[model samples]
Target: MLSYATIGVTDLNKSEAFYTELLAPIGAKTLMKMDRIIFIGKSMKEPMLAICIPFNKEEQHCGNGNMIAIAPGSIEKCDELYNKAIELGATCDGAPGQRIPDLFYGAYFRDFDGNKIAFNHFG
Candidate 1:
């Protein structure tokens, strides 16, 4: 029942690019200016991470154990992004494939650091 989620990152520009590409399908809104902290979600929804702050790089991964599941508009979208991410130098932690066939069809990829992010589309 949450409107969004936020995470601290070390590099603002890089993380912005990564997330902007990653969250394209979900229509993620990016806003970060000292003058104002804009709301990503709609007026009725809660805000996600508004600003990108510095964090320890010594950490194992860019993300916590929790998996951020993004809903792809379609299976092809997932396939395209999954492939694009891999092509863009992201490690393919898991290939795009159906987990349980009809039930769970998705893909997982590792970000700049090491985060197991998944994208799914239930046909």
Candidate 2:
């Protein structure tokens, strides 16, 4: 039921670079860009993930218990994407592995802005 999600950042250039690499393995590309925000998705019309400077012109911070989960299509893809994320400077929250035997496999990390993100597959 979700349509899109956004996270606030202090540095738009840094956030853009980080997310461009983080989302590349999943084939998500830039869908739009405005002065202080950018939207990315598999297609322009699909659900998007946006990174932006806080509209209120205040400091940006990560939410206490919020995360963005990305499905990379399969267990292997999830692992690959997770590795790529780390290589591009994301800090690991959880390594890629089966989280629920034969049911869920996933990996977690925090972006440069400390926003949590995940890649997972369900079987």
Candidate 3:
């Protein structure tokens, strides 16, 4: 339904570092991008991280207010991914847990640039 998904950020390097470690075990990585943009998702040739060159003071925070949700396979995998994201330094926006009893298990995190990112496991 879409070509790709992008999350904005403030620091490319910090975001890159965080993403590299977080996405590694999941098979996601920095694909391609300009200095002001860092694409970290699945390939190093695509830009999934649309980070801000510098901290934008006028920018609002990252949240459902403006965020993307990625659903992996199982709740356990979701938990692992969420843990990896945090271990790499992404801020915890929402912790990994049952979002809806027996319905959805997911977790949320804020990237280095403060973009809201989430992982959901529905199966």
lDDT of 3 by residue, 42-66 (tens): 6545435444454455553555587
Return the TM-score for each candidate structure.
Answer: 0.70, 0.94, 0.76
Indicate which candidate wins on lDDT: 2
Location of the lowest summed lDDT over 10 successive residues in candidate 1: 35-44
Across 1-123, the per-residue lDDT of candidate 2 in tens digits comes to 667899998888887887777788778878789998999888766778999999999899899999999887999898888888898888999999999999999899998789999999999
Number of the top TM-score candidate: 2
Ranking by lDDT: 2, 3, 1
Candidate 2 shows a clash count of: 0
**Model 1, runs deviating above 4 Å:** 33-51, 54-64
Residue 29 in model 2: lDDT? 79
lDDT of 1 by residue, 33-54 (tens): 4422222432335435343353
Winner by lDDT between candidate 3 and candidate 2: 2
lDDT of each: 0.63, 0.88, 0.71
